[model samples]
Target: MVVGGDAAKEYVAGFAAGVATVIVGHPFDTIKVKLQTHNTKTQVKEYKNAIHCTSQILRSEGVKGLYRGASSSFIGMAFESSLIFGIYSQAKQLLQGETESIKPQLQVIIPSAAFGGALISFILCPAELVKCRMQVQGRDSANSNYVRYAGPLDCALNTMKSEGVKGIFRGGFTTLLRESIGNATFFSTYEMSRHYMHLQLNSNSSARSQQSKILSDVGIGIISGGLAGMAFWTAVLPLDVAKTLIQTAPDPNSSRDPFRTLGSIYSRVGLKGCYAGLGPTLARAFPANAVAIVTWEGAAKLLGVKRD
Candidate 1:
């Protein structure tokens, strides 16, 4: 039935795209999470950089270590991406109205994207909390000193049992902030870039060159998507660091108020702590997001998503 109509097709497209995207980018995500939550006060930091981190994981935990917490990511992305892309398309359309403008206005896109981000943050919070905690486990002497969850499901279940439902929403405020700001920048950048590219590439082309135009659009999508991805990460990296710390904190009994988590990060490591994993996060942004946005766009096109 989902394949029987446009709305269904959109859902299916987003679901499939999310699955493919997590596969392509999960290792990079793992590294980024580990880096973000790394405590500098430890006897020694777990890794010096992305390279050393990858090397250590491979040498110590094997390839599986690189994929730690991926199951949670898959579950998170499946729901988060579907909700975000689906809601964003609907919201953008409402903003665009029945006028059928030739192109989307920035005013229409910015708020729509922000709303979508805000909506998905609630869904993303719990899954992301489990994912980050699982990813960073075993690295710490405390976790090494005790038992860890069997997997993401176990982590979520245990968290719920011990701390109730609200425990899963750790860092929810920061997640909301990060998603809203990042996604606003992300969608706006992508739209503006793609529009400019269209103007440049299609200005002189004719009907006979349609294929070339399509190819050009694909190329433009990659670049624009990369730019959008980078903008999102760079704008929200500090908040993201705080979110990771709150989500991965060993003590669920401890408060995870956004201001408190932020203050803790600053107090312990100063400004640099908030940007701890910036290098790896930026490195992951380009290729991973380029691929995700392209795949999402390509899938949406096939499913007739025009506004987003």
Candidate 2:
């Protein structure tokens, strides 16, 4: 049975971290999404580089523009992070059981994390849809077919009204693929990185055991979380590009095959199209996710979560 307080702490920690994530990293996310959806057409294109995009947003819409979708992102990610973390911890507990001998080894962790990733995709779909649609608006050309959403609630209502609830899951396949692979590696990286960090920083075994019990250092969490983000993005960015494309499509009803679009983009722009916003994404991933993971772990600890 799941312990009540433990899950509550996990949820709260994840929520706090999710808020920090949006505050710290939303601008980079905005730029990354913008770049990912940039048009290479001859007539009307806005941003040329990450720096240029930052400049454009600052100039045109001021600082507030950089946080265009902050509301949707903040709220959605709060739930998204909370669910991912709380569920993952509970799932991990279930998988580990009372077998202290198992040691949360790679065999156990990889699959458990994958399970959490898959389940979290349910919440991520709508969150991502609203965030992507909001981010891509006003940036499109005057003749573009994109729709402007007033906010997250309006976005959800309109989407459901026109296309039904299924429309909320527009790019769900890609989200699942990305999150499953990404989180599998994320947990693995965190476990291994912590062990390695203890080795490098703690010369004495007793000292290491006491000091590095669990998320003892914010820096370690940041480093490992950043490493995990790098691993996740490097492995799944092409799929992410495709996911964003589908999620941010203009006509909600005008459906084109996702697999075909992935193929078409790959064939047209080679690997470049698939990796359009990689730089900014990587930059954001490290700091953003680092803060998130650290906050989640730290908050759980403060709220009385026991060390494994």
Candidate 3:
């Protein structure tokens, strides 16, 4: 019997990971969103690059500008992470069957992770829609097109009222593609990295103290998690750019298909346009996901959750 833990505890572990992700990643995410949607509602680009965007936000709106939509992100991430981790763990278990001690095959890992990512899209689309909309509403007095909402709740309600429920989920398709592909890459990379790291560590465990072993586990988690995050964004950042465009378009009726949106962006600004926020995104991906996985593993251990 898998006596240490069950599937439900995965949700609790996931919730901790989600909170950690937002705290470390939200600022970078804000900058990424801003850079991606810089010209959405205006004729001129407000930011030349991530550095310029960050400096401008600090100058004009202070640090708060970078956290505009974090409220929604918190709620979204908490629920999103819980569902994703829980679903992925459950799926992986079912797929692995009685081979609990064996390494997970790529076939099982990718499909199980992708399934979790796909389902989370329904939740992520709306949460990100609100987050993007809020992030783009800058304090630039020159840009008169900004639609300022009182808060995330206001943004959600207004979107619901104006565009119906579909408005809240404006970038559903793009989000689905991004999440599914990104998560498959994420879990696979993490698993592979951790597997190798564990092999290296186990060979030396007899020579190390218990405290040293704990520290080594944390170090491994950070490296594996950071690598997983970078891999995820590298694979699906173009889709994320399209999703931002769709979500933050001034016109709610803009094309929602990610491919169509990408084509339009490519025609206008070439490849750079398709990867507008790559810098900040990659920068944020490492530490944010590092913390997330560490927190997740810690929480799982605390909750007595079992893992193969």
Highest-scoring model, lDDT: 3
Candidate 2 structure quality by residue, lDDT tens digits, 1-308: 23545778888998988888898889998898888787421224467788898898888778988898788888878888888777777877778776664233787678878888898888888888888888887554477667777777888788888879889889888889888888888888887886678567766444545445554577788898888877878888887888888888776754435566678677766767778788898999899889988887788778887665
lDDT of each: 0.79, 0.79, 0.87
User: lDDT: which is higher, 2 or 3?
Assistant: 3
Give a tens-digit lDDT track for model 3, residues 1-308. 12325777888899989999999999999999988887433336778778998999899889998898999999899999999988988888778777755454788889999999999999988999899989988765365565788888998999999899878889898899899999999999999899989988888665888788889989999999999999999999989999998888778877988898888888877787888899999999999999999998989889887665
Which numbered prediction scores highest in TM-score against the true structure?
Answer: 3
Looking at candidate 2, the ten consecutive residues that score lowest on lDDT are 39-48
Q: State the number of backbone clashes in model 3.
A: 0
Quick one: how many clashes does candidate 2 have?
0
* 191 Cα displacement, candidate 2 (Å): 1.4
Supply candidate 2's per-residue lDDT for 277.
Answer: 83
Q: Candidate 2 at residue 32, lDDT?
A: 84
**How far off is residue 154 in model 2, in Å?**
2.4
User: RMSD per prediction, one decimal?
Assistant: 3.1, 3.0, 2.0
